[model samples]
Target: MNKLKNKVMLRGALSMLLLAGLGFHSFAQKKNWQNLDLQKDSVFGIDTEKAYEELLKGKKSAPVLVGVLDGGVDINHEDLKRVIWVNKKEKAGNGKDDDKNGYIDDVNGWNFLGSAKGSVSHEALELTRILRRDKAKFENVTAAIVKPADSAAFNQYLKAKIDFEKQTDEAKNAVANIGGLKTVLDSMVKKMGKEKPELADFQNFKAESSIEDRLKRIMVSQLQNSTFEAFYSSQIVKGLEHYQDQLDYNLNPDFDPRPELVGDNYADSQQRNYGSNDVKGPDASHGTHVSGIIAADRTNTIGIQGVADNVMIMGVRAVPDGDERDKDVANSIRYAVANGAKVLNMSFGKGYSWDKKAVDEAVKYAVSKDVLLVQAAGNDNKNLDVEKSFPDRRYEDGGVASSYIVVGASGPNDDKTLKADFSNYGKTTVDVFAPGVQIYSTVPDNKYEAYNGTSMASPVVAGLAALIRSYYPKLTAVQVKEIILKSVVKVNHNVDIEMEEGIAPKSVPFADLCITGGIVNAYEALKLAATYK
Candidate 1:
C-alpha cells in the first residue's frame, strides 16, 4: 500500500455543524453531559459521576500521574495549575540540568518540539515533508527511469504528489465557496435582533438590495437545515479556519520551520537530547483541553470537573500545529515513562510514519515499564482495517502492545445515533468507544469549549484509566486495560451510521465497529476493578 497521509484535522465539518445546530440552544447551558449516567440522564456518557457517588465515596486514593503528550498545555490555567506535576528534584529558574535527564528546568515536563532558542508553532505535514524530499528526484522521472529496486519508493512519491494536490485544491475550493459566510451570518443576526432567528424571519422580510437578497437567500437556506447559532459556529466560524490551516501549514509544501525553530538533526532518529523546557509553546488550546479532560481541579468550583480525581497531569509538548515527527513522539513516550507517568493520554495521530522503528522502540519501552497508553483512533470515517493511523498499538515486530488502548469517538445519544459520524472504526483497530462529540473541556486562558474529535474521546478513556490506577493502585496497566474493555456497556441495537454526505446510512452492528462492541461505562469499570484485588 502507498504511504497514507493524514487528512489533517477532524473530518465532517458539515455534520458537526448540524449536530451543533440541533444542540446549540442548550450547548452553553450543558455541563458535564459526558459524565451523566444513561439511566439517569438518557445521555450515553461514561457514568463518571455515578462512579464517584457510589463506588468512590469514602475511598482514599493515591495521586496518579497522567502524561499529556500533545501540542502544548496551559499549565498555569486556574483549573490545571493545581494539578500540574512539578518535578521535585528540579529547582525552578536554575537554568541548569538539575534532574540531569537531558532537559533543563523541566519543572512540569519536557518540550521535544522546542530548542533553547524557541519553539515551533507550524510545520509541514508528513505528506508535504515526504513530497519535499522526493519531488526533486521524481518530479519528471518516468517509470522506465526508475530502477526495479526503487519502484516502491517511486510509487509512494506518485501517490503523495496526487494527494497533496487534491487536498490543496479542495481547501482552495472550500475557501472560495464560503469565504465571507461569517460576515453574512453576523449581518443577518444583527438584522433579526434575536438570539435565534427562525427560517420564517425572511419569509415576509424585504432585502435592501439585490446583493442583500442573494445573501439573505443563502442564510435562509442554511437556516432551513440548522439553527442560526449552530450554522454560525460550525459552518462559518469553524469551516473558514479549517481551510485556512490547510492553505497556511498542513498542505503547504514549501513551508518549513524546523530548520529555523527546532534546529534538530531531524534526519537522525536518536537526537532526543536537544529540546527546551518550555512545555507550553505558542499554542496550547488543544493540549490544555485534553489535559483538562483527564484531570482538572475538582474542588475549585471552576469550569468543569475532570473524569478522574487525585490526578497529576504532566505536560509533554511534542505535537505541533501540523503533523508530529516520529522522533518527537518516541522521545515524548520515553520521557513520560522515565518521569513517573503511570498513564499517558495520546490524543493525536497521523496517517504516515517517517520512522516506524524509532517509534516502535519507545512504545516497547512504555509497555515494559507498565505504563498504560490511551490513543485516539482517528477522525476519518474510513475503516482502519483497510486504512492506516500512526502510533497505533501494533508493533513492527510480532506482538501488539498490551497496555495500549485505541479509542474511537462516541456521542451522548442512547438511540441509533450514538456513533460519532467522523469516528474511524475497526473491529480490530479500535479497542473501545468513549464520549468525544461536543466534549466540553478546558482550553487556554482559563476558558472552556466543546471540541469534536477522537482527540477528545481518547482522554475520556485515559481519565478513566487514571482513576482506576489511582483507586486500585495494585492493578497493572494491562489489568486496567482489561477492566476497561470487559466492563463496557454493550449496545445491542444496530446503528444506522452515516458514512458520507450523499450516500445512504450504513447500518452496521454496533459490535462490528470496535473490538468492544459498547460504550465505556465508568461506573461498571470501577465496580469490576474492586474485585481484582
Candidate 2:
C-alpha cells in the first residue's frame, strides 16, 4: 500500500512537470514571433521582417481610416501632415457646407467646442456643470422643495449637489491647511534661490540637525508643500466659481446648450447639420497624442511610429478637456462612419453622463456602420465592474449593444501583478490590458511625452486594431475584436499589481484581472489577421 501511494504521488508530479514545460515552450515561441525586438533598427514599433510578411499576405494595399476623438489634432505637425483625413466633399477655406453635413466646410473634421482656444479639464467641466445645475435650482427653490420630475434629472441633480458640497468642503479644508505649510516652503524656495531645486538640494535641507529639521524635511521632500499651496487656493476659488456656474448655466438636462451655440436642438444627433470643419480646435495636445499613437507617420526617422503604416487619421475634435457633451460624441461617430473611418479611438470618459440614451444610440449606430469603438476604461483606480463609467458597451439594460472594445492599462513586464495603479479593471467591463504606463507617444507642436493612464493603453490596442483591419478588412469589427482577444498570450507568473485604495497588496494571476488576460501584440494580431485572410 505504501509503494502504491508513493507511485501515485510520483506520477502526479511528473504530469505537472510535463504541462509546465509545454506551457513555457508555447509562451517562448509566441513572444519570439510577436515581440521580435525592433528597438535597434525600426523607428516604428513594427518588426520590419514581420511587416514584410504581412505585406506579402495582401495587407499592404488596404486604405483604412482611424478617427481620433480627443482635445484636437495639430494639422500642421510634420509627422501627421500627409496622413490627415481630408473631407473630400468640401473645398478648404470655402466657408460653405459642400457636403451639407451642417458643418461649414469641414475640410478635416468638426470642432464641437466653439472657437477652441483654451484648456478645459473634464473634471473642471463636470464640477462646473454639476454645480451650475444645482446652484440654479437651489436658488429658485429650497432643497426641501427641489424635486425634479424626471428621474434621471433628479438623480443627477442630487449627485451634483453632493459633489459640489464635498468639493467645496474639501477646497476649504485644503486652503486652511496650505497656509501653515506654505510658510516653510517659501523659506526653502528663497534659500535655494531657485523656483525648482534638485534632489540634492532637498537632501541638503534634510541634513540639518536643528529644532526645525522636521519642518524643513517635509518642505523639501514633497513638492506639494509649495505646489499644493498655490493650487489649493485656486481650487477653493474654482470650487466657489463652479458652484456659481452650476446656478448660472442651468445645467438642467431640460435646458440644452446647443441652441445657445448653434441655435439648434442638440438632443437630436440625427441633426448632423451642426459643427464647423475647423479640425485644429482650441487645444491640440490630447488629440494629437492619440493620433500619433494610431498613425503618426512611421519610418520617417522623426516622432514615434503610430500602430499601423497604411493608415489615415481622421481628426474629430468632439472631446474637449471638459466633459464631452453627448451631442458632440454622437455626431463625431456619425461623421467618422459617414466619412470612412474604420476605427474610432475615444481616450476620454466621465462619471456623469446626462444624455446616456443619445450616446448609446450613437454607439449602436457605429456598430451598424461596421466601425469599431476603442475606449479607455478610465483612470480612477477603481474596479469598473462595481463602479459605473460612461462610454461602455453594456448599458444598465442586459443587451449587448455595439462593437465597443474597452481597454485597461498594462505594463511591459510579463508579471501579472504590475498592472498600473490607476487602471480601472473588470472581467466584463474591461476587454484587455496593454502598455499604458509611461507610454512615449506624439504630442502637438512637434513634440512627444510619456504620459501614463488607461487613456494611453486604449490607443495601443486601437493601433493594433487598425493594423488588423488594414491587413484583414474582410474581418468584421466583431471578428477583429474576437481575434485580438483570443490571440493574447496569457502569462502564468505571479506579478505584484498595485491594488485599489485601502486594500492589502498581494499577487494574482494576470488572467484574473481583465477579460482578454493578455497584452496588445501587433505582430501576433497581424499574424492572426493574416490567417483570417
* The candidate that achieves the highest TM-score relative to the unseen native structure: 1
- Model 2's alpha-carbon lDDT is 0.63
lDDT of 1 by residue, 238-339 (tens): 678767877898888789888877888889998878788899999888899899888988888878999999999999998887888889999999999999
lDDT of 1 at 284: 89
User: Whole-model lDDT for model 1 versus the true structure?
Assistant: 0.82
For every candidate, C-alpha RMSD to the true structure in Å: 4.1, 12.7
Each prediction's whole-model lDDT (CA): 0.82, 0.63
Off by over 4 Å in 2: 1-59, 115-153, 171-183, 194-196, 206-270, 395-398, 493-503
- Error at 411, model 1, angstroms: 0.6
lDDT of 1 at 439: 78
lDDT of residue 85 for candidate 1 = 97
Best by lDDT: 1
